[model samples]
Target: MKKEYAVIGLGRFGGSICKALSEEGLEVMAMDMNEDRVNEYAKIASHAVIGDSTDESVLKNLGIRNFDHVIVAIGENIQASILTTIMLKELGVKMVTVKAQNDYHEKVLNKIGADRIVHPERDMGRRIAHKIISNNVLDYLELSDEYSLIEIVANSRLAGHSLLDLDIRARYGINIVAIKRGKEVIVSPLADEMIQKEDILIVIGAVADIGRFEKREMQNDY
Candidate 1:
């Protein structure tokens, strides 16, 4: 069965989520205070409505509690975001995801029982910065404040070496979880497997360790 979703504040983040869910043939109701924004998503989302989610009555009228998941993507307005999240939880929405502006806002959302708090802008900035600083780093995903998963293009230095020879876990305190070569992906790669130049290494480790490995090993080769 397709899960139903209600997305409040039809901003970039919310609109994108709505569009993706609709593309997957899920039921999605997009809402925003601005009629213009609601109108824009009417053709894309299953339903689009102009209403203030901060008001419990408005949410009730929209049948928001019936949705399986609700996303509070109210941009800039922290108060409305908090109120809506709280109301959704109180009304027994199965899940509530919210976009937090900063650390303080995130703390408040956490206290108010938001199922997930996303810092999209801040996370995107970090990913872009990593890619800009090193040609080897293709992508970065923060698993936590200290740990991250990174995709690095294997350089000449890494080529012709097996995982056993590199002893990457012992030396760098990181793990090569997978290797992507061309269209093939080798997950949980064996220790005897050799790395080839341009092979994409999917590594996971502490942020500091990953940084050190990239700077001392990958970047220095070029």
Candidate 2:
């Protein structure tokens, strides 16, 4: 069955998600209090409506609880965000993902049983910082405070070396879960597979261990 999604507050974050989901042929309900915002997404979403999600009656009218997932992306208005999230959970929505303005906002969302809390600004800053500090790191995703998944470009030093030869798991405590070469992706790569320059390694491990691996194996090698 196809999962349905409701996105409250048609701002950058919510708008982007609606567009992406719609592009993938998913059913998306885009809502916002602002008529202009709702109109903007009318052609892009499966359904777009001008409604304030903070109002329990409004959400009920939209049948938001029936959606498989609801994303609360109300910007600046922290109170509205909290209220909307609480209402969605209470109404028995399967999942509620919210955007937190800050640490205190995230704490409240966690206490209220939000399924996911996103700090886009903070997370993007961390990703950009990692990329700035290491030329090898192409992208970064934080799985938790302690763990992360990163994509790194293979350099000359790592080229021609097999996973067994590098012993990355034993030495760095990081696993190359996948390798992206050109347009192909090899998941759960074999130990004997040789790494070549320009290959992009998708690795996952503790954040500290990943940093150490980048410093010792990638940065120092060149």
Candidate 3:
């Protein structure tokens, strides 16, 4: 069955999610206290309504409990975000993802049983910092505080070698899950698969281990 999603607070974060989900042909309900914001998304979302999600009665009337997932994206109003998340869980929302304003907010959401907590600003900053600091790191995705998935471009030092020859896993505790060569992608590359210069290696490992691998393999003068 197709999952149902509702985004409360028609701000940039919530509105972007509603549009992206709807673009993928998913049913999305866009809710907000501002009539203008709700109206703006009426044509984009499956359903758009102006109401305060923090009010339990409002959520009940909107049939929020039937949605598979609800995202609390209320801007600035920390109290409203917390109350809305609480109501959503109390009403048996299958998944409640809340956006945290800070560390304290995330702690509260975690204690209250939020299915997921997102710190957009903090996560984005980490991504940008990785790109700025590493010449070989093409991209980065944080799987958790301790682990990450990184894309690193192979250079002369890593070229002309195979997975078995490098023995990267034994040394750095990271896995090269895939290799992106121009337009083709090789997933779960075999030990004999040759590493070519400029190939994008999709690597995953603990953050500290990845950093160590980067310092030793990717950033050293050859």
Candidate 4:
């Protein structure tokens, strides 16, 4: 079944998510106080409206509670964000995801029962730092504060080694969940499957363990 979503902001952060969700063919409504921003997303969402989301009457009229998820991506205006979130929860929204402008904003959102809080700048910084630390790191995704999923390009030193040879899980405390070789992906790779240089390894583990594994395994002399 397709889920319904409503994005309550048309700023850069909110716009990107609205577009991505639309591209996936999901039913999404984009809302904002800016007439121009709502006009811009008219064709990108199932519906686009210019209105103040903190207004309970506007939300009730739009039947906001029926949507599966609501994303409060309002920018800068922390008070409006908080008010809108409180109204959504009060109206019985199934899930609420909010963008935090700072640590204090996140704490407030948490206390108000937001299901998820995203810090775009901080997460992007972590990804950039990982890329700077090693050329092998292709991408980084934080599963939580402690764990992450990372994509690493296999170096020549890892070419001939099979899963059993390296004992990756036992040695590095990480699991190579999948291997992407060109257009092919091997999921849950067998212990005997030998790795080839340049294969993209999708790994997940504790952040500290991944740093140690990358330092000792990926940064060593060939």
Q: In candidate 2, which residue pairs get closer than 3 Å at backbone N, Cα or C atoms, i.e. clash?
A: none
lDDT of each: 0.94, 0.94, 0.92, 0.96
Residue range 1-222, candidate 3, lDDT tens digits: 999999998888888888999999999999999999999999999999999887889899988899999999998899999999999999999999999999999999998889999988788898888888778888999998899999999978899999999999999999999999999999999999999999999999999999898888887737
Candidate maximizing TM-score: 1
lDDT of 1: 0.94
Cα error, residue 29 of model 3, in Å, equals: 0.6
Model 2 alpha-carbon drift over 4 Å, by segment = none
Clashing pairs in 1: none
Per-residue CA lDDT of model 1 for 162-184, tens digit only, reads 99999999988999999999999
Query: Candidate 4, TM-score vs. the true structure?
Result: 0.94
**lDDT string, candidate 2, 95-191, tens digits:** 9999999999999999999999999989999999999888999999999999999999999889999999999999989999999999999999999
Alpha carbon lDDT at 80, candidate 1: 93
What is the lDDT, from 0 to 100, of the residue 39 in candidate 4?
95
Better of 2 and 3 by TM-score: 2
